[model samples]
Target: MEKNLAQKYNHKDVEEGRYDEWVKKGYFTAGDKSKDPFTIVIPPPNVTGILHIGHAWDNTLQDIISRYKRMQGYDMLYLPGMDHAGIATQARVDARLKSEGISRYDIGREKFLERAWQWKEEYAATIRKQWAKLGNSLDYSRERFTMDEGFNDAVRHVFVTLYNEGLIYRGWRIINWDPEARTALSNIEVYYQDDPGKMYYFDYKVEETNEYFTVATTRPETMFGDVCVVVNPEDERFSHLVGKHAVNPANGEAIPIIADSYVDVEFGTGAMKCTPAHDPNDFAIAERHGLEKPICMNPDGTMNALSGEYEGMDRYECRDKLVERIKEEGNLIKIEDITHNVAHSERTHCVIEPYLSEQWFVKMKPLAEDVLKNQNDPDQRINFYPERFSRVFEQWLENIEDWCISRQLWWG
Candidate 1:
């Protein structure tokens, strides 16, 4: 009490004391590889992040398992690393420069990327410091970054080998585009929200007839590239116009009425506009009809030349203009605001624009087949937590798309 020099809790005083002791005791070091081996890789965190609650929880669990393995006298390796999250890291650096009143373009790509590497080094140092605090028994001596030369070489080697095997390809495909990032994203990166919006109805004149059929759609602006109108072949309602075409409500472009099983007979009058350039399902229909797939928007979700007067405008703005134009043409139908799940880019957080673009992809059918076969035979299978997630895993494997693997950015 005289000096207030000694505290009741000496944890802080023993901080450096405990860490050095643990490391010196070889608790953090790996045993000889000759011993019965045990290894658990510490999941690499995104380079753009600091430790959060989820990281804290996850690392805590890993630490417990590693400690138990060491006690069991197993040679162990818990290697630590960071994932160079391309878009996320780029966005973080861009944001930092924005605060400093500078732009990446002003600094040039090499310089900007050098700055990003600096940020990564700082964060890596902090991560090492934080992991120390958490007592994670990760082998920092062998730490790796996903973007390091050796890792990059491995990535390139895999890519080249897969491409040579025809398991990789580049082609025109329908993809969910991130406008703000101007990049093609894998389907897994898309997040959905229930959005409240109106579906617009427009009248289409039947070719060689004065009568017109109305279509109800949530995305009216995509009418710019309508190649056809689709309905179920068994749909008795539109059977009369089955062999004919329709005059586009706004552009007067004639598009044939085609029957396809993809349409659900009960949804929105059972009549759907086929805009191959803007919808995935419609792209399939276009291929069937040998329709020319002209793109109406850029990867960044801005209007392109196919949009005519709406060219260069943002997609939502063009949507408004298209609706107004149809209204003026006396072909506009009623609109009702409704809630629905809208998909957005996970990186840019912009509404996902379905666009036709050239991109690199991975053929996944064989990979999925192997996963499914293993999953179906439960005796020799991996696992899922909570039990319910097992069904989700199975479902995902069943419907896995060809993975889009390219990014316009350099750090991927």
Candidate 2:
């Protein structure tokens, strides 16, 4: 009918014609807010995006609700927007530029940012166009981008206020880092996968006394950052060596072997490597002893200057190289293939790097107390569709990590 009817009749194209009319008539534009205002913030599509079926469904639902509310005489503010999706948006443009023989490095961050803003303006129209087709009553005049001045100011304000209120702090904490995107990601952005890898058993010799103690590790690449060797304080297996040192086979660096009550006595060798910069558990141990964190790899998960012999190699490559070195020294006791969960970035899908960074984190405890203890309000008017989503909302907010809102990318 689309092909045959259009040629036979002068009827305007249904999708485009109606969409243009609605935009011009301003049915979708929100008027001034009254004392009573109703708003359903359409979850902003990431700026690094194209609308898919799921997004379309979401917009359709929101539009229906907004229209219903507008008819009910509520000042409707179905705010439209897009996210400055830091890594995601940057990756999209970067890939598009790769075909043109241009890299982000060639144009620089400033120019790349300009191009990204151009992208936002271009796609923002498509969002409105989609909404119009779905017959949604969105206030296009008030459409906001995540990077808009007011919103960015709000993000900054939240950060500064939280900091002043002692609800936010900077500390050397273990964070999930994206290797390919070179950024710290919130826990929500990480997906876990079971990886098949080997656990290497290396004999650590005391520096002063030639007595040896064995430690098993799945990640030999982090050996360069090993500051201490920890054992269960009550474990009888290695109680004699409580105050001794252990020699890292490949690095020959001596690390104090101490007993900690936190150590699980059953987990291999009853001893673990304390790499403050790498393992979350080790960071706690380091904090207990007031030791410095030495990050062995770059933000991209490549060996940094700290990884002496493997400075230019990938972290995984350094693993193999380090294993070989340990094997030659006769410290390699045994190897076992084991399945373990590894976290990967949601955007890049690359294995995440665990790094100690002084990133910002909010104290969720106080926020939780307020939100949990407060009674459900009839006048507050908070709502979500499908009703089930409210449970998801409550559950998410219940155990939310200190939101790390910073990103390394310049473009969005």
Candidate 3:
């Protein structure tokens, strides 16, 4: 022990020598069956990352707990790892490629993925070296990457099992789609911006009756996809209008005027346009009322062939054209200036469209039920740090919906 100590207290020399000795002695290794096991699985950080303060804080806390357990005569297995960070890593590589006057599409998916793995290897080594600098007692030998073959197999098995149990399904549903990524993102992956907007009120002529009723909408461009105009069933003024059909001002398509409880009578016009293929709430109303879902826009935010004359136009461009067309046709009742929040893609910073696409989803209700049960149990295995976090967990589990898991990106 005296010989191991350096005459001069040099951190670099002393620490490196000790770490090398520890590694050589297999002190940070695991797989011994002769002791009480205490395992700690690392919350893998994104590989497309630099060691930051947050990473240091998290790893320090984990290391503290792991070391305390080890001192208590437990066989500690604090496994270290990093995630491939699918979308994030791809975005970074794409940006890098763009700087070199090239794009991921130029090299194709296979070549792009090769570059991604190369980037992974380079940064992962940096992350590991940075983690080692902290001298955390981690089992480096048991390191796992999210995209590793064993991890990939585990993920596939779980997905297949869920699918077999009917917990996983595919359907054409309205999702927050990132036009740039060309992928459907989950609700949590989207951020919203509050901006000024106008609510356009247009007259929809009742087919059965010659009388015209005004329906207010924020998106006039999506009118081409409108399948029904809904009103509160309890509203006496529009109760008589139920079972009637109205002509869409944009394309002159005869759409049903249905009455449902989903309509907010206090809101604008007390009438909501049901564009099942575009709006999530409207999609739900359409499903409840059995309405046809006619998509007006493509995945890339361009109007599709179903949009009549507005076809082949960008959504914003179509909005301008539709407004002018509606004004010319004498269907424009009034336009009220309003402010609203719109969802945007977290990665692309592009306006996210509530697009209808066939994608895989996992039923979250059952999973939430299990989580809630575990949370509420008196002898719960996991405990939240702050007691109030338990309530937040409960609230999240209570209001969970089906999670969209599939993305239209080649990276993952």
TM-score of each: 0.89, 0.86, 0.86
Clashing pairs in 3: none
Superposed Cα deviation of residue 268, candidate 2 (Å): 1.8
Question: Model 2: what TM-score?
Answer: 0.86
lDDT of 2 by residue, 146-235 (tens): 878998789889888888999988766899898777788888889999999888888888787797778899999998888888888789
Candidate 1, residues 152-266, lDDT tens digits: the string is 8998999999999899999998988877777778888899999888888888889878788889999877777787888899999998788798888757888888898999999
lDDT of 1: 0.84
Model 3: per-residue Cα lDDT over 1-412, one tens digit each? 3557666788876576676667668787877688799999888999876789998999999989988988887888999888877667777888889999998889999999898888888999898778888778889888888878998899999999999999999988888898777788999989999989999999989998799888999998888889989999999889888989999998998988888898999899898888998899999998998888888888788999988887899999999899998899899989999999989888878888898899999999998899788876779735888978878888988999899999887776
TM-score of 3: 0.86
lDDT value, residue 84 of candidate 3: 78
| Alpha carbon lDDT of each predicted model | 0.84, 0.81, 0.87
Candidate number with greatest lDDT: 3
Backbone clash pairs in model 2 (N, Cα, C under 3 Å; residues 3+ apart or in different chains), count: 1
TM-score winner: 1
